[model samples]
Target: MTDNSAERRREKQPRTGAEQPWEPEDLVISEGKDPTPERLEEARRRLADEGPSAIERSAP
Candidate 1:
């Protein structure tokens, strides 16, 4: 029989960014801390317009 435990060791671990993926703060469009109201509005506007196109857009 094959040694399956070796394969278990090679399993990929899930990424854990500081914030959970669904948090509102995670979607900030501002450069850094203390985002202005305009920046927040712009971020929200872009999200409303873009939808799924904004998510995980990078190619394989």
Candidate 2:
């Protein structure tokens, strides 16, 4: 390429060339409970505060 620094920067990006068609309706997660907006918000908060271990805390 014209500039080595520009090529390096492009390589460090998080997104890849191939990706799925992103859609909000496709996200349907349930922890054995009804998919309510409040429950989803609580789960998000728990995950952010507790990290990956939060998933295990949910009852099957």
- What Cα-based lDDT does every candidate model obtain? 0.46, 0.50
Global lDDT of model 2: 0.50
lDDT by residue (2-60, candidate 2, tens digit) is: 66997899788755311333121122242556657876677666665765445544423
Candidate 1: tens digits of C-alpha lDDT, residues 1-60: 889886787565543332233222334532344556765676566556665343333111
Worst 10 residues of 1 by lDDT: 16-25
How far does residue 58 in candidate 2 sit from its true spot (Å)?
1.7
Shift of residue 46 alpha carbon in model 2, Å:
0.4
TM-score of 1: 0.38
Residue-pair clashes per prediction, in order, are 0, 0
Relative to the true structure, candidate 2 has a C-alpha RMSD (angstroms) of: 7.9
